[model samples]
Target: MSNIIGFNNAIFWTDDTEILYCEFSNTDPNAKLESTKAKLYIKAITTLCKGKAMPFVIDLTETCGTFTTSVAKFIVRNSELKKLRISESFIIGTTGVKLLITLYKKFYDPATPFRIFADQNLAQAYSLETKQKYHNSIKKVVEDYK
Candidate 1:
């Protein structure tokens, strides 16, 4: 079982050793993400990571509900998340305008890798597999790619 760490009315946020996992809250599928609540969610992530770079596995199911501009900014552009050190991110259930809107909100930070997936399990597995690929390789390349 996952350790219960924080609260969300319509989103499920779980903490693990390798990544931050988020999905729609089964308890409140109809819940909407208010702009006011975005801060709480963003802060929770930075607090949990505590400066360690980690991958994010996000399920955007509930996000299809009424997500506002402020909420999008909070999720994708908050300067506070710099401390969270997001190594990479994996998203599920986003397409069309929603995906484009989200893509627009995220400012390109070349260091951060972003990917989309259809399956949470695949995203999770890849997140773990690619953990070291982003967080560990700091030294300059002494050799060309094989």
Candidate 2:
């Protein structure tokens, strides 16, 4: 499931990869994302995760950072969805001021770690590596039990 625009500020996902890509529109400064869409985005992510922790690579390349809070609020409101732990969140090109905010969040929610990078490639690579390690750890546990 992928290529969904104006739905959640998120864009793509594929079966082969463990990355969820979110892009807040750089072109439209006043792009309004309704609350319903925010809920849907959370729903979509939870469904995609299928009862496992999932990491996201958010591309905040060029956009006012308003819509992000809406999504966060929805996640906070849902008690059952708390188990949808974000293994990692890589935000691209949010340096200087936004970087500080992200840093605070990193410490605030240590359970779901995150990294900031100027380059999307680096973020994606690290996300893939983290994802692999998670899968390997889970696999080892299952094998041991078997």
Candidate 3:
């Protein structure tokens, strides 16, 4: 029963509160994905996540940006916030992706599972885990109704 609510470039999937899956394809450079959109998504999910033992996977594989310092800070803030809510959180950036891990080295916390994979397998694995969690939640609800 996992659902993704999105519009244009921003997408938020609901499966794991601790682990939110998001992808931003900047259709226009001026819009700036890091603005309110990214922050809202983070705040919304964090509020919903509460105390779930979930992790996060932010897929920036299709993103295109200047990778400015501001955007990097936004990503870092959200990543750290996710970790605080979940057991752990990781950001998955593909080869030649938009977000640059090096730029945020100063703010990078080793305790958080920050990583970049050559491909989307790691993100996919996280999504599958979220799906399973959703399925179980739904099953439990159905059993309760029965």
The estimated TM-scores of all candidates read 0.66, 0.68, 0.57
lDDT per residue for candidate 3 within 5-72, as digits (tens), equals: 67677676656333566666664434445556666776656654554435555556566554455765
Q: Which candidate leads the pack in lDDT? A: 2
Overlapping backbone residue pairs in candidate 3 total: 1
Indicate the residue-level lDDT of 103 in model 3.
40
In model 2, state the lDDT of residue 108.
46
Superposed Cα deviation of residue 41, candidate 3 (Å): 1.9
Off by over 4 Å in 3: 16-18, 27-31, 66-95, 105-110, 124-146
Error of 1 at 110 (Å): 7.8
Ranking by lDDT: 2, 1, 3
Tell me the tens digit of each residue's lDDT in model 1 across 108-139.
44445666677767778778867766554633
Alpha carbon deviation, residue 2, candidate 2 (Å): 5.5
Q: RMSD per prediction, one decimal? A: 5.0, 3.8, 7.7
Q: What is candidate 1's local distance difference test score? A: 0.59
* Candidate 1: count of backbone clashes, pairs at least 3 residues apart or interchain: 0
lDDT of each: 0.59, 0.62, 0.54
Model 3 TM-score relative to the real fold? 0.57
